[model samples]
Target: MAMEGESWPRVRAVLAEIFDRDAEDILPETLIMGDLGGESVDLLEIAVRLNADFGIPVDEDAAFLKSLRYLLAESREKGIEPEAALRAAYPHLSAERCATLAREAARPQAAPLLCAADIAAYAAAARK
Candidate 1:
């Protein structure tokens, strides 16, 4: 579904849920490494959730993932729309309406790949 308001909140919500943390815990400026405490595997898991939820297949190849940040930066530089870039990468996500998605996200659903401290060893190690 197409997330409206151009709000990255949906992504944040997914991340927070997967991390077993409160939504307020993640600021827009937080880094996955320093602030959120994530690693390559955690990121891969996040990508997986993003794929499964949106029905977009994220190419995990280094060439693909590495170019992700670059694409965002390039999009910003070129004044191109973020959705355009997102669509370019993943065609399955429709331009879904915000009201529709709000209704969808509100329902009780299965959580993503979330783990507590003992289980999320990578997150724990990142704390050091």
Candidate 2:
């Protein structure tokens, strides 16, 4: 909810990255499935990433996670609760887990610290 102007661009970039496409050409009016040729799995990835980054309640179930900007905008405009629809669409990330995560994310970071070893470990782990 606190996302500023940079958030939209971030979301768009994440979506494009998930689809292995160019981010520059992506726009709010772009038809995800039609113009981008993303499939169900692709959508699931996008939903998970969006849910993680945006902290929005995504109903995991529903016919499918289709329509990019239109559905989100409509839900926002109509004050529709998307968590239910998202639950209907894909129930993997349960409401309880979502709530718990939101609470945890709201908490401040424990410390501002980093280590070269940690970065090296992360890089090494990613290669595994």
Candidate 3:
């Protein structure tokens, strides 16, 4: 397994290639969907590329947080706070970021909050 630091540059390169943007523009905090205008198909391509580049299988849903909105809704239905649920579902994210994402998820038409760091974290974890 590569260290997180080592995985970041590869992930950044993959994202830049997929999004047709400069690698310098794909910062850790850059939103994949919101900032890069990524769609669900792009997420699938990212998973495929990461899987090949890292020589590890990348679960699309886990890597890209594909089920985040569903998780949020399920949590609310089960009387769990969305922030806590988000943290449980995505431990790669800081609790504070999870809280912020929870609020974003609650908006009627919020863009997904998945970021470049989240994908890199997932790839690094998969390498383990």
Among the numbered candidates, top lDDT falls to 3
Q: List TM-score per model, in order.
A: 0.44, 0.43, 0.86
Per-residue lDDT tens digits of candidate 2, residues 1-128? Answer: 22224455666677678767787776644555656776668657765765666655444332133332234445557886544433433343346433433343334652111111211222222223
lDDT of 2: 0.45
Using TM-score as the yardstick, the better of models 1 and 2 is 1
Model 1 residue 98 distance off true place after TM-score fit, in angstroms: 28
Query: How far off is residue 111 in model 1, in Å?
Result: 30
Ranking of candidates on TM-score, top first: 3, 1, 2
Error of 3 at 7 (Å): 1.4
lDDT for predicted candidate 1 compared with the true structure: 0.47
Best by TM-score: 3
61-125: candidate 1 lDDT, tens digit per residue: 32122344455457678997655664464332333322222233234652221222112222222
By summed lDDT, the worst window of 10 consecutive residues in model 1 runs over: 110-119
